[model samples]
Target: MPGVADGQGLGPVLTVPNLISFTRLLGVPLFLYLFLATDATGWAIAVLAVGGLSDWVDGFAARRLKQVSRLGELLDPLADRLYILATLIALTVKDVVPWWFTIALLGREAVMVLCLVVLRILGHGPPPVHYVGKTATAILLMGFPMMLLARFSEAARPWALPSGWALLWWGIVLYWVAAVLYFIQAGIHVRAGRAAAAGAS
Candidate 1:
């Protein structure tokens, strides 16, 4: 079918959204290098800005252009996670964020992964992207670059550092809340799956 894929989401593989996602995925490593290796502030900011902009662009294109796909849905979150991972790694190496913070963030993601595996075993699909989760991601993404600027540029320290730290912590708290919501979502799906199976039998 031209319009469906394995009874999942959209069908196309080469969608503008998917391509943008792949590009963002690739940009993760490049962003890491620029931030951690070269410390090229201008280029790093450019890449981060473009990547952030592309995030919005891809989603809009997916809906307006009708190019959404299962691959895209998967890639989009994966890219967001990679970006978060990359930011965490680079900042953690730089001692920009505390170890506990990293652990907390990664821990939530790890639990989500486990929950997803359980859902799959129960023949359910991935959790829907919650608005809370998206807001958390956006806050963190925006905060990271500001934190970098705060670390690297003395001129921007007074404002950027405070704002960045504020946003970052807010994002972290809300992210955990989103994680809790996802767990509830998983539980609902699990019960539904079990009920469906029992009915069928």
Candidate 2:
């Protein structure tokens, strides 16, 4: 998720956009239940479609209505991550994608976590969301639904599968590239902080 502007206060917690993000978060478990427990592929896809659409809607609404808040910023990305993780688990369980594919994506997330930790230790919060990272996320979100469609719908299998894989591959590449950029950014900040501290001492 994108960070608030510099000097912007963490606005109120309650807002329309935050509510939309919360709704998207709730759909994550429902998606898992529909896809995994009930075998309702169609409904699961419907839930995913709504989640993806709402992702965009909430962002637009936030900007348009000036309802952006710290909580909304957090909730938006949290919802996206939860949906991606849920879909990955479901896809792995169904044998639609290989275990390594899932792990590779998750591994990128782990790297991000480490980067955040390193930054925090240096008295810095997370850096602003990079455009490349946002693009990767958008691509992955779109790719997963197409992959599910390709897997379950015979009619869509021909085109959806190839296109889905293409998107996923591109998304993964960009995902790792973003991770590397974030890591480098963190290192630079840490080094700069230390240099200043040393000079001060």
Q: Which stretches of candidate 2 lie over 4 Å from their true place?
A: 1-10, 191-201
Q: What is the C-alpha lDDT of each candidate?
A: 0.83, 0.83
Q: Write the per-residue lDDT of candidate 2 for residues 1-201, one digit (tens) a residue.
A: 343443456666667788798889999999999998897899998998788767678888889888778877788778878887888888899998889999999998888887788788779877666778777877887888889999999999999999999989998999899888877777777888889999999
**Model 1, runs deviating above 4 Å:** 1-10
Weakest ten-residue segment in model 1 by summed lDDT: 1-10
Clashing residue pairs, backbone N/CA/C < 3 A, model 1: none
Per-residue CA lDDT of candidate 1, range 1-201, in tens?
Answer: 233455444567766788888899999989988887895866886777677656667788888888778788888888888888888888899987789999999999998889888888878897788879978987888888888788888999999999989989999998999999999988887888789899999
Q: Tell me the alpha-carbon RMSD of every candidate.
A: 2.6, 3.9
- What does the lDDT read for residue 109 in candidate 2? 88
